[model samples]
Target: MNLSLDYAIEMDQKDPLKSYRDLFHIPKDKFGNDLIYFCGNSLGLQPKTTKSYIEQELKDWAELGVEGHIEAKNPWLPYHEFLTESMAKVVGAKPIEVVTMNTLTANLHFMMVSFYQPNKKRYKIVIESDAFPSDKYAVESQLRHHGYDDKEGLILWKPRKGEELLRYEDLEQIMQDQGNEIALIMIGGVNYYTGQYFDLKRITELGHKHGCKVGFDCAHGGGNVPLNLHNSGADFAIWCSYKYLNSGPGSLSGCFVHERYAYDKNLNRFTGWWSHNKETRFNMRHDFDVLPGAEGWQLSNPPILSLAAIRASLDIFNEAGMDALRDKSIKLTGYFEYLMNGLGDDVVRIITPSNPKERGCQLSIQVKNANKELHDKLTDSGVITDWREPDVIRCAPVPLYNTFQDVYLMVERLKGLL
Candidate 1:
């Protein structure tokens, strides 16, 4: 790949997805120049239509009051259903297997309540050693809740010495040794720090071979890659909408329960009013006739404004399609990786997988002889990327709105910083 600015501009000119960049509001510097944004892994840029999406709901609420539940355009009662089909498409699942609901950690706990059934003979849980702190905390609490010692009951799958990415063989060895004693296997679909995308189907099959339930926290994988959750055959999975989904901060999370459990009335779960049957939902006090599939996990009615923001973003995804997005992302990040390689192995080291299939659009860069001040300087220079703990700069070039020129400029800025 050419490192010249003209080459980058030429690549952008010939791009099929160049028009998508104008769909979002890109941030600008004090001088009014657009900033090279690389932090979509932390929080995605707002889509141009998000404002109108929320304003429509506000307009309906102001004019129709309680009548907005039924009379308003898009109707508030089944607002989440509006997002189901598109969201399912992003994560590669059937509509009946997916639903938009609570926050990431909350949904993780709710899923554990149903899937983490432990017994004296098999009561341990396995997760990556470097999982997001919230997932670690949630699993620890689940262990204690079931009267097991947190540290004793929780098993970690660690990388070998001098390695950053996890090997599938190491995990297989863990299952080989402790499969009979483990009741659950929960893993991050993508490692947030290293941008390593795990093989969900392989992990699920290995867990199932040992009679263990499997699940994934797809907070980093959602919209960033083709998860194919249904094909993975995981018992359940959850992901947030704020990051790659670009649904605004703290938007509702998506939950996926495999079709095999869709109509399992005997399954143990924590249910609420929102999970009841739509036919008898407003008929006052009655027995809880739970809705089928992932909808049966909802605890309360959702906030429509957030759902509106999600709907706006998902509409864009529906138009662009995940297959198209994945194709562009492979090229975008491949270019980023190529440029970073030109910086010399001594100057900066890339920890993310070189194999495009093993990662998404993110590349975790580690600069030699650098500290947090270096990152601050990059921000001052109008480039935005995040610094993870220990040593690594996490930058995701989102395919939906990011361009070839943006990736080129970001690398040029990093070269200057070095």
Candidate 2:
């Protein structure tokens, strides 16, 4: 079957979500044409409105000084609060259960410190074999910090032999074998390399049934997928806003502590002044009064500029609800797969889950006989995609801004490269 590039472009022209493509500042090549940007899974293209939101914060900082905390157009003291309701809506979480806080890894450690209560009997943590590097490092460091050998405390739930994806049954089998000795199950909500979105509700239920705490490193899942973290009953979760959230590089990340854990004072946590009771915080009392919800996890004042970028992004998210965004995402990414598969297995293979419900926006393609050279060729040809080590290129067509034509054009470039 001939893959007609013009047909894909025509599909883009008729796409209902096509107008969103203009919302982002798509990158230009040396020739100044918009490059095919399929790297939203890495760093999303910045929103065109980001400048104005940042400008507002910068102007307020210039004019108000410390007074900006109280008197600025958007008061810095409660700026994060402004984001709560909308961000909660985007992630299928309750407002009190979520907070925009520290970086992803930092928040992961903080949450683990509170949730991963490894005792003498149950001192193990189970994680996916292909978990992100930072998450593995954080979990390993936590084990060492608690005086447990990583080999003893860390249990990896791996894929089957000669397989690229992990099955839920594999996780169930591990739980049956070691659940009695496991204290926590920390898995990436979406596998970073394979783009597999786990069945969070099922995983959470399995973990709880086995008397284990469940948490998620949602860096790849957060905005890219509709994660009902609250309803899924995940004890805790962390996600960065820079990727699908489109909040700029190194932007503030988010943390979620289920509403069930909100007022559980018996629950352990590493607290700070920001987590102190806001009502009497200004009074400067000696009592370690903690906030009622996830805000109780805050350690320091968040950078307003970073939060400003988040606000800009969340505003866009609020306008384009997660359900609508996800609907578009399935169709767009399916188109990407359809186009890539058209090239046939002799050239490329998609490792990401075939079922759209089982994955998000990313399609991890393993180019046969292709090293970094083929990836570089695609980059040089103006198709921007990410190469994960060994041999996989990840391309995410974000529903918020990526059009069907972007996916179509990207495949055409790869066909040319081959």
Top-lDDT candidate index: 1
Predicted candidate 2 versus true structure: per-residue lDDT over 369-418, tens digit per residue: 87999999999999899999999999999998887778877887888889
TM-score list, all predictions: 0.99, 0.98
**Model 1: lDDT to the true structure:** 0.94
Q: Give the poorly placed runs of model 1, Cα more than 4 Å off.
A: none
TM-score: which candidate is best? 1
- For residue 169, what is the lDDT in candidate 1? 98
Model 2 alpha-carbon miss at residue 30, Å: 0.9
What C-alpha lDDT do the candidate models reach, one value each? 0.94, 0.90
Model 2: residues with Cα > 4 Å off, grouped in runs: none
